[model samples]
Target: MMKRLKSRLSSIVIAICLPVIVVADPIVGVWKTEPDRKSLISHIKITACGDKFCGRILSAYDASGKEVQTPNIGKKLFWDVVGEGGGKYGGGEFWVPLINVDAVPQMTLQGDKLLVKGCEHAICAHQTWSRL
Candidate 1:
């Protein structure tokens, strides 16, 4: 019947468009990073870049919560990050501003927190960032 054919076509259309409708990844947000060795905190803004994701430092603050001017602001902290499902992401490069080096990065999203880790050879470090 025509009604049955039309219903099947509608189902197919929805199935094809579902992925596009849900294109926004949960990782897209502003996250507050843990204080570094200098006791400075950074707020990173994560956004969609092509099919992957990228994060940049939006601002920085001192230990007393006063916003400070830092050259690292507006710098790309991470890029080419791809979500691997189950709240895990990897395949990205992380920039360590303090050390002026790059490392392989991995991330995991848990509720309002994000665990970001970077490894260079045998050395590894991680920081927990809270969503703001």
Candidate 2:
């Protein structure tokens, strides 16, 4: 049980060191998403937006990791995620930029990575975003 204990200890330290508000909200930060079909990756900044969580594309990079200019930059990637505790969040709208559709989102936090998924009926997509 050392792993579990260590995990608890680390969480306790995080709770003690961070401000009450910051500790309560663990998703406030920049996250780098996995590369898309075109091998393009984007940095999403998650923040509190009107009592919910919203993510916007802060920047995008090409396959070679070179920053590129695009009109879609600064667009909203997702919004309206409500925290459900235990590292779970839901009730958000996630944008499918490729198909130009919006889908319901579900998210789970795992340490420094966030598993973000979007679903519409039987269709779904997910990405693992690393904290930046």
Candidate 3:
């Protein structure tokens, strides 16, 4: 009887702890793409649409910190962010129309940095993102 009671308690504990082991949506935040020292691409809002993730262009500014109106607003910067388990995400694509570029990136959340790498089999551009 004591062994059965202990087994039941262990089961209950495991059930309660399973969800704790899972992580929340870490990519749902703001991340800026560094274009250069004088300017950067501002992804004002990063959010999940169903199972996929996307980045929205809040605004774009040029050198010397000025908001320059561009044709990229309300565009989907990233898409198809899939969970690869262990708080890592991959198999996603980002579309930046201003530059006419579309690439696949592997995403990982480390502390406040949402590291996104655009890898096209031969080349890659790393974009480090901080939560706004």
**Every candidate's lDDT:** 0.92, 0.89, 0.71
TM-score between model 1 and native: 0.84
What lDDT does model 3 reach?
0.71
lDDT of 2: 0.89
What lDDT tens digits, residue by residue, belong to model 1 across residues 1-132?
999999999999997775453357888899999999999999999987777789999999999999999999999999999899999999989999999999999999999999999999999999999999
lDDT of 2 at 12: 93
- TM-scores of the candidates are 0.84, 0.81, 0.71
Q: TM-score of model 3 relative to the true fold?
A: 0.71
Clashes of each: 0, 0, 0
Clashes by residue pair, model 1:
none
Off by over 4 Å in 3: 1-24, 36-38
Find the 10 residues in a row with the least total lDDT in model 1: 15-24
Question: Model 2 compared with the native: what TM-score?
Answer: 0.81
How would you encode candidate 2's per-residue C-alpha lDDT over 21-124 as one tens digit per residue?
A: 54359898999999987788999999877568899999999989999887779999898888888999999799988888999999999999999999998899
Error of 1 at 128 (Å): 0.5
Best by TM-score: 1
What pairs collide in candidate 2?
A: none
